[model samples]
Target: MSPQPQAAVGAPLSRVDGRLKVTGQAHYAADHAPEGVVHAVIVDSGVGRGRITGIDTRAALAQPGVLTVISHLNAPKLPYLDNPGGYFNPQGQKLRAFQDDQVHFRGQPVAVVVATTLEVAQHAANLVKVDYDTQQGSTDMTDAPSFELMNYARGDAEAALSSAPVHSDRSYTAARTHHNAMELHAAVAQWNGNQLTIWDKTQWVLGAVAELATVFGITPESVRVLSPFVGGAFGNSLRVWPHTVIAALAAKMTNRPVKLVLTRKQLYTNVGYRPRYEHRVRLGSDRRGRLTAMAHELKAETSRYETYAEAILDLGQMLYATPNVSQSYQSVALDVNTPTPMRGPGYSSAAYAVESALDELAHELGIDPIELRLRNEPQEDPAHNLPFSTRRLRDALRTGAREFGWHRRNPKPRSTRDGDWLIGTGMAVGCYPTHRQPAQARVRLDADGTALVQSATSDMGPGTYTSMTQVAADALGLTMRQVTFQLGDSAMPPAPPQGGSITMASVGSAVQAGCDTLRQQAIKLAVDDERSPLYGADPDKVVVRAGRLSVQGDPGRGETYRRLLTRNKRTNLEVLGGWSPPSGADRFSMYAYSAIFAEVAVDARLGLVRVRRMLGVYDTGRIISPKLADSQALGGMVGGIGMALLEHGEFDNRDGRLVNANLADYLVPVNADIPEIRAIYIDGEDREADPLGVKGLGEVVLVGVAPAIANAVFHATGRRVRDLPITAEALL
Candidate 1:
């Protein structure tokens, strides 16, 4: 069957909330100020590990405007229920804020000061004194005391690797990375008796609501979380952090609403970050570049309290299709806040190691990198033994090559020199598995000729509002201006957390269901009403278009929805839309694919590497918004550039300190660092993934990007660096 007439989907539609954002009307978490709201400032533990021996808050309480101070000594211990389902919670108790005197990591919140103003709160917090008995804690991943290997196997990988005629073994490491969003980690909490309401910057509001309710020993319904606008999350706000709890506790203790905002320095410690990864790979291939055996080991850092994990072994198992494959994964506990998912998470880091190895193998075999990949492309998912719903990676590679003029380049390293710079071209394959979760939405069409859609989801700077509006507009045959899409309120219909690249597939399917159901209701009414012009028309053939219900073959014989609803004495027609995972989903392997191409210029004399241009060709299924898709592609590339050459966090294991915690010290890409970027998407659909035919696109755009740039750098200079931020010193 043909799809619906798409007037909004696939169109270059601008964001519906663009005006609200640019005009400063958008209110983020810190922007909310309720009646009698106070401020809360938190104090950090100076010691890495130990027990607080003493506390002195007399000076802080004596200061003017200081409301009160909270510490483990004076704070009430109602409940600290276990958070077993947190994205990265490990066995044993999760860290409880203000529950005890024991400190688990440096920068742990030891005390909080509340005051009438932010300045007074900060000053009072500084005046408060705390003394602790210090103990040394292990903060280095390489010096971990214990290890437990995870599960992954195929045919005997060790035997295959030893028997193979051509093979290479290499190691790689990625530095820890912080998610420095435009907005700081903040929360505003207000409690009216037992009911708790909070405005916090978070990626998962429902998770926050659940955690807060469990901690306070209240019903889930008693807690409400609001995060209407988020500057940027990148998975940092996916979990319920310690600071959020501090804000709520301060508010409840003082019997007034309280706001808490993390300083730039504090943002590095409490909020989660992308863990540093240590990767080792041993791969073998035939003369034609077909993979024979693949074995890899991955180790990443986590906090002593929580064990974090992501999809890191996916590529080694199935990416290139080998007869024998083995993967060992382990998490090294350290004295830091628990790590969380950051853009692309494990796949992006794994790609840097695997793609770079593939490029090296291709160079050794004198085969074009693209040609080598084509030789090993799998007919089905090698790991799951399932047919792909859609895999257009070949098409993306061909198109990207054609568009980027790949044929004009020389493959030999340092061969294409232009005086001060040696230029080269490189490409890598990208993959990110598709994910879906149950979602619900409520749609209402009023007699006033307008529609309202509500869901408990978040945007997080992804243009979710505009894209969702487009989905509803097309499904219900309504113009963009006539529809209002609302999100980020717990009062709305239930929705999955808006991360893991699942929002569009999960929430969008629900939106389509709601819109289509509401439209069908209108059609049934129009076809059955004796007073309507379309009476006696078959309901099966009736269609809604431009607010009018008409017979499929004859559009002229129809009545406007406004007239129908008014004549029936009904104010609105409402329906609840829901989506469940398809039963057949398990029969197919679903993933979004991309072919990233990059050109680089390296100065041999000064050891400087610069990206000249970049192109990302994606096989993400069924784009609902072209303009938004293009923006995502560009943004992903920019982030990849930073990952390849600039972004890295320094830590002092001796003191359990993140050395470059502030933006001024930490490096990220600026406008002057990026070059021209182009994004092209293969037009296609994946019906098996969802009703909307969308595979997750957010994570796929970032995968393979760092590797593509690194390969280009290797081609420009004969050096191969196994660590991240491919430094100038390494190039030299």
Candidate 2:
């Protein structure tokens, strides 16, 4: 079959929903207001761990407009049925709100106050007091007991390390960090008997439906979720949280629509955060800096009830061509909410340890960092024993080095300085495994010459709406203005959870398939119709351009979709296109790779570190939307800057309560802190990975970012800080 004409797919188009977002017309979860909707405010426990003793609701009930204060003592028993859970949910019993007296974490919701207005609900929630039997809890992972979750060994790493000529053994710590998306976690639930409708801020609407249905002991089809827009998530809204359950339960109890929006403080604990990690990496290399053996040990924080794990060990096993590699990953049980994937997730956490260790080894061997990485580049994935789908990491490193002027940088730390500032440059390779899940998109071509494409995917600041539309427009041979892409509704065709950087490869492929089907249907219709201009033309040789189906190389022998569909007496043509990871996909190691370079300036007297600039060259296949990809890469660089110099989730060890929960306390890179950031996408495609020839991009951009910045800091100060957020105290 002839391919559809390429028009919109590679264009650097602006987001189709940009106007809606900038005009405040895009309705997020909290913006939704069902008629007669009541407000609910969750009253969370102040103690880290304990059992509820008594609840007092006299003052709260007496307050005007206060409807009800529900707690474990007075709340109805929910079925709390078992759920298999989403991709990100840990394998354990989930926290059931208002149905238990046991408080496992400091911010566990103990009660909820419902009122006519949000302000009234807040007031009542504060007034309704609860007493707890507080017990000391282990919030610190350093002293907490941990159990091994994963252990892998390809060869005798210890023996090889002992025999190697050079070794660098180092421990690294990454502090807890919050997503802190601009939009707070919010849910609005309206229940008509057993049928439930919820407007919630979530990356996966169907995931929320399943969880809510299981919690209420109802069928999954009875729950409907609508989340058209998200301010930003960074993996924060990927799971169904307690507040969503609270909203639905409150609405059921009150027989009115209930809206629950978490405050900024509540967001810090109620939603998931990046778990604190402690990683120790021991590397052994030859005189030429070729890795001989590597050993990795990592322990991350997780709630006592659940075992949350990520891809922390994969990087150690397959990232390079080490002859011997052994890895152990453990999760430390703590009195805190279960952690979830943040931007880059486990890959970013591991990159800091592995890449920083590589940098250390390079320094010890007097070899350039880029040269060391090239020396250790693997011909095949040593862990899986598979060839790479498309490995261009070396090209990315070379391109990035050339673009960033790496040749001019001094090798010696603290060698380049300007007045009171020390200057340094560093680079690190980034990689994230390419992921694709089964996804389906529905496409409809109306007789009016317009198309509507929809999937259950989400746009949590990644421009899903625009990118999918681009795929649809080109596949259907329609102009961008004639095609619309809709998402974030559970009622649409099913799609996998919109995390893991797979949406484009999965959902966009589905969209393209659906549009291609519709376009082919139009061509068949025209060819079969004797009255149509393209009568008796070969369907295989027909191609579409701007809604007109024409014979290949003969533009004049065609008719518009409007003319053909109207003649056929059909109102619209519809098709459901679907895609799944092809069989034998595991035969190849698929990953998106990048080379991130950072330049930093360290103040001599003040010990302040400021990033001067950053450049990221990526080998992520087939840029779907260049503008959005650049935005994603640049944003990732800024986030990496924060991870290196500013962001830290300060937990009070006494109670596991996050002290710096608010934005005022938690330091993110502001505009002033962000310097010029540029992103480059290599010209290539990964046909072995997907039909679209595209590998995932979102997570890859952030994978090696923190390490690049951390390595740069070491170059600037001549001091290697093992801990993240290399603070001023360490520099001083």
Candidate 3:
């Protein structure tokens, strides 16, 4: 059959659920309240590492409206079955709440207080006291022992670095940061015999269902998870935290529905956060700015009980062309919570070190930064030994340079000034691999000329609801108003976990396939009907528009789907379709690309750095929704600014406690701090990547932002600060 008309695919449309969200009608996880609901408050350990000795719950039990105060000493022992679907922890076991008396880290949940009222729960939680036998522990990654996580080598990098004409070596450090989204993590769980239902703040409903079932030693089919709306997650909500399991356990023990919400301060300890990292980059280049050899050594913090690692060495191996390259990544186990993927994951951290080192190399060779990057563009992926599906770094660089007026930049640092402010401009390139997994979606078209598409995926503020609707409308030959998309329920068709920028490629493709199948089924029925206007027409030449089936280039020969279905006594048409990526090695290396540019002004006397303007040019393939893409790009740039000059997770190593645990002490960019920002997309699509031709967009937008701002800071001031959140003291 002929391709569906591309009417709504690239349209700049508003969010479909905008009215509900603006009017406060949309309910988040914390907003849910099941019947007979009771409140639960978790009491955490004060010591970093120790064993519980004694508990005093008499005062808490005497309080009015208090249901019970249960700790490891009084709580029933759970099965604690092995969870194969749990979050990625390659080395150690995940944390199990109330399973034992051993305390692994500070802020570990020790006991819980359940009460008829939330106020009573809070007061009773403080009344219950626990004593522990404290032991010394290390929380600082710089002082902890390191274990080798991964290593890679292509050639003799040491020999090549020794003989190179010019060399650059530098060390860069990034402070740990938290997601701190507007919504707090919450869960409301209810149990009926063996069946369990939970409303929780999570990125993956099916993953949570699987995890909860394993922890309680129940069948997966007995669990149902629902999370219809999420304020924002970034990456913290991808896993099932200990508190979620605690809520379920509490409901089972109390025989009443339980509601648990993490306070703002509790968020710092309960959920996962990005870990602090230290990187050493060594580069060897020729006088002409071509790279000869490169080596990277990295160390990051992780919980002593669970190992956490990311693709921190990917950029060093693939971003540039080098004959010899070597990399080693290590995790320094600390007395802290396990780190999780935040925002851009590994690429964002890697960019700061790799791009900053490249800028230094550009200065040493007396070559333009963009020009030097252009000189070493690899013809193929050196690590994968395959051609790129669509590598548009060159196009992104040239487009950003022209739009940002790169010709006006002065090569000398601190050469341009406006009154007391020193002005400078810098640019960097970023890349993220395209990831796709198995996904299935269901589509049903009613005789009333409306459609409903559903999947088990989620929308964590990336406009998944709007984008999927667009794809479905186009595929089904219907208008935007005639289609509705539903998500964030485990009862729907199975879908991959929503993270890693894979939702669009995997879930979207499934929607497209299902809609296309149902539309064609309607057309086939019409063409076969003897009484229809489209009777005897070739099915290959049929096209649909506004619920009407017509022959190609013949508007008069058509029939409305409502009339055809009503006449045939059909209620509705339905189909279930899925999309799966091929197994084995891919034929081509696929990745999204970005070229980011930033301009900053620095006050020499006060040591204040202000971003004046920013621009990001992206080649992330087809634009499903232009307006939402801009929102993602601009938000990422703002986050990058925080990484460069505002955000930091300070730790008091004496007890492995986060000093700035609250938002009041922790800093983020506000309206007064952000400047004019813009996003541009290069025109193209990558058919080799996915059926939708979209290489994921969310993660790549944030990958190179920090390095771009950091490089601009170096140009504005003569001094180079290797650490993140460039402070006034460092500048002075």
At residue 49, candidate 3 shows an lDDT of 90
Tens-digit lDDT track for model 1 on 1-732? 123467888899999999999999999999999999999999998888889999899999999999999999988896876656545444546778889999888888999999999999999999989998989988888888546537699999999899888898989888888888899989999999999999999877788888888888999899999999999988888878889998999999999999999999998888888889988889898888888998888898888877777878887677887989989888888887788888898789889889988999999999999999988899999999999999999999999999999999788888988899988778898899898999999999999888999999998988999999999988887888989999998878989887878999999999999999898888788778999998988777776677777777787898898999999999999999999887653899899988999999999888888999999999999999989998889999999998989888887889888788888889888899999999998989999999999998887888999999999998988788789988889977
Model 3: worst 10 consecutive residues (lDDT sum)? 82-91
lDDT of 1 at 546: 73
| Candidate with the larger lDDT of 1 and 2 | 2
Inter-residue clash pairs, candidate 1: none
* Pairs of colliding residues, candidate 3: none
Per-residue error at 296 for model 2, in Å? Answer: 0.6
List the RMSD of every prediction in angstroms: 1.4, 1.0, 1.1
As a TM-score, model 2 comes out at 0.99
Quote each prediction's TM-score. Answer: 0.98, 0.99, 0.99
Candidate 1, overall lDDT? 0.88
Instruction: Report the lDDT tens digits of candidate 2 across residue range 1-732.
Output: 888889998999999999988999999999998889899999989899999999999999999999999888877888886545544778888888888799999888999999999999998898988898999988998789999988999889999899999998999999988898899999999999789999999999998888888888899999999999988999988889989998998999999999999999998889888989998999998898989999999999999987888888888788899999999998899999999999988889999899999999999999999999999999999999999999998889889999999999999998999999999898898789999989999999999999999898888999999999899999999999999889999999999888889899999888888888888888888999999989999999999899888988888889999999999999999999999888763879999998999999999898899899999999999999999999899988888888888888887888868899888999998999999899999999998888899999999889888899889988998998889988989999
Q: Residue by residue across 460-537, what tens digits does model 3's lDDT show?
A: 999998999999999988899999999999999999878889999999999998998898899899989998999899
